[model samples]
Target: MASTLKAVGRNVLFGLLMAAAFPIALAAQPSHPSQKVTVLKVNNGQEVLVEINGEGRAVRLACIQAPLEQQQPWANQARTALSNALPQGSVVEMELRARDVYGRVVARLLKEKIDIASPLISRGHVFAYDGYLGRCDDLNYPRLERQAQRSKAGLWAVEGGVSRPWDLIEASGRQTQP
Candidate 1:
């Protein structure tokens, strides 16, 4: 009985030491942040799941939403650009700003592996999404959009150009706050 208790105590002490050395709180703490990620899937029209270090989860792009899967003139180019930016297993450092009820992390997408939010804006993919109007004005954005439209890139390639996600969501009788 005495020997058994001593062995158990030693095991307990070892366990405690290990835990103290590396607390459970420290688990999954990213060594760095990624603003971009692999397009795990275009979940629905507004949101997507991206992988950070092979672990997948949903991330809400900060400014504009790409065209939902069904919407014609959808930002197909945006999706393609994003896909190219973050290929599978590509390291995308994200700075998680917050979480929505949908269990998605809201963040500013990066450029050149930085948290610039330039990619979404420069491409004219989103209209400086009202939630972030102050950040980038719609003036030059339209120009960029025009450029894309001229090139028939992605959604622009569509004959009438891509209908904004807001228009589609509203047409569908869904929320259109953006």
Candidate 2:
């Protein structure tokens, strides 16, 4: 009981710190035209390190959420899928949406005009992020996710898909305030 209380306190403190440190408002507007950028590395399923203007930047893929590392094979598989899609040194078009609290660019990535998040959602490698769909194609993403769920693809192949990343974080005594 004492440990649980401590965990809760830590989570609350962390949330307060995050909220105070990054208070920038995110605009729910369409992103700017695509800008060519080189992929530096795949950070996870929904994020990557890229080079823009000869400077390194972290980009969070908009409209999707993938398994967290603690979720094991699914997380690794999601990361691998993203890595395959955006291999190191590969140049892609990035449509900038907004900067996230962590200072990562939240954007939609495209290769040959193909929206990368589409395939990931359709394959069930990631969940259509419902929380922040204001800047995305709200309808299309959820539709793709539903189709993937119906077909039991990728992470959804199990009896039920793995716990959502945010839920997993919450279960671990962490707060996902974004």
Candidate 3:
């Protein structure tokens, strides 16, 4: 019985070691590779349409959801803010991740090596999106969001400022029903 228990313990330890090593290996593999593209338009704070290799592709900002244009206090601001940061005809680098349900390639846009999401999230223009893939570690997002909330920056300045787009969509769905 002692020998059997020892074998089991060894197996468990091996399994734990493999589990811990998996993510580090995956991180080394680079889930999203950087690609240069021309910015056709900033769809919103969290989405942009770009021309890559002469093809137009919609890229949603990974790990964030900006308010829609109708969300009052945030919608229009989000769009305008993104537009200002990435103007038309601007060339930028995109770290492309997997696609969403809408077929847009989720990515992190970088202009002059500066991450575009930083300004949006830090200023309270968007939220630290929790719906993205868990394995993709976006460091400093939670910290930036907390600072924005504490400072009452951008949309956070208004009462009930941090309303998510998904929640607003759901609320509108309920309102329109018979």
Return the TM-score for each candidate structure: 0.52, 0.77, 0.76
lDDT tens per residue, model 2, 1-178: 9999999999999999888766443344343766999999999999999999999999999878988887889989889899999989999999987788778888889998898889999988898986663676533898999999999999999896788887777677976533
Among all windows of ten consecutive residues in candidate 2, which has the lowest summed lDDT? Answer: 22-31
Candidate 2's displacement at residue 151, Å, is: 0.5
Better of 2 and 3 by lDDT: 2
At residue 95, what lDDT does model 2 achieve?
A: 92
Q: Rank the candidates by lDDT, best first.
A: 2, 3, 1
lDDT (Cα, tens digit) per residue for candidate 3, span 95-176: 8767777788888888998988888989988887755765247556778888999999998998867667778778777542
Please name the candidate that would achieve the greatest lDDT relative to the true structure. Answer: 2
Over the full model, what C-alpha lDDT does candidate 3 score relative to the true structure?
Answer: 0.81
Runs off by more than 4 Å, candidate 1:
1-48, 51-55, 115-117, 132-161, 175-178
| Model with the higher lDDT, candidate 1 or 2 | 2
Model 1 Cα lDDT, one tens digit per residue, 1-178: 9999999999999999998878655763443244556556644333457786678887776655666656544456556556655555544556655566666777655545554334554554544453442333322444555566676765555588667767778778985434
Ranking by TM-score: 2, 3, 1
TM-score of 2: 0.77
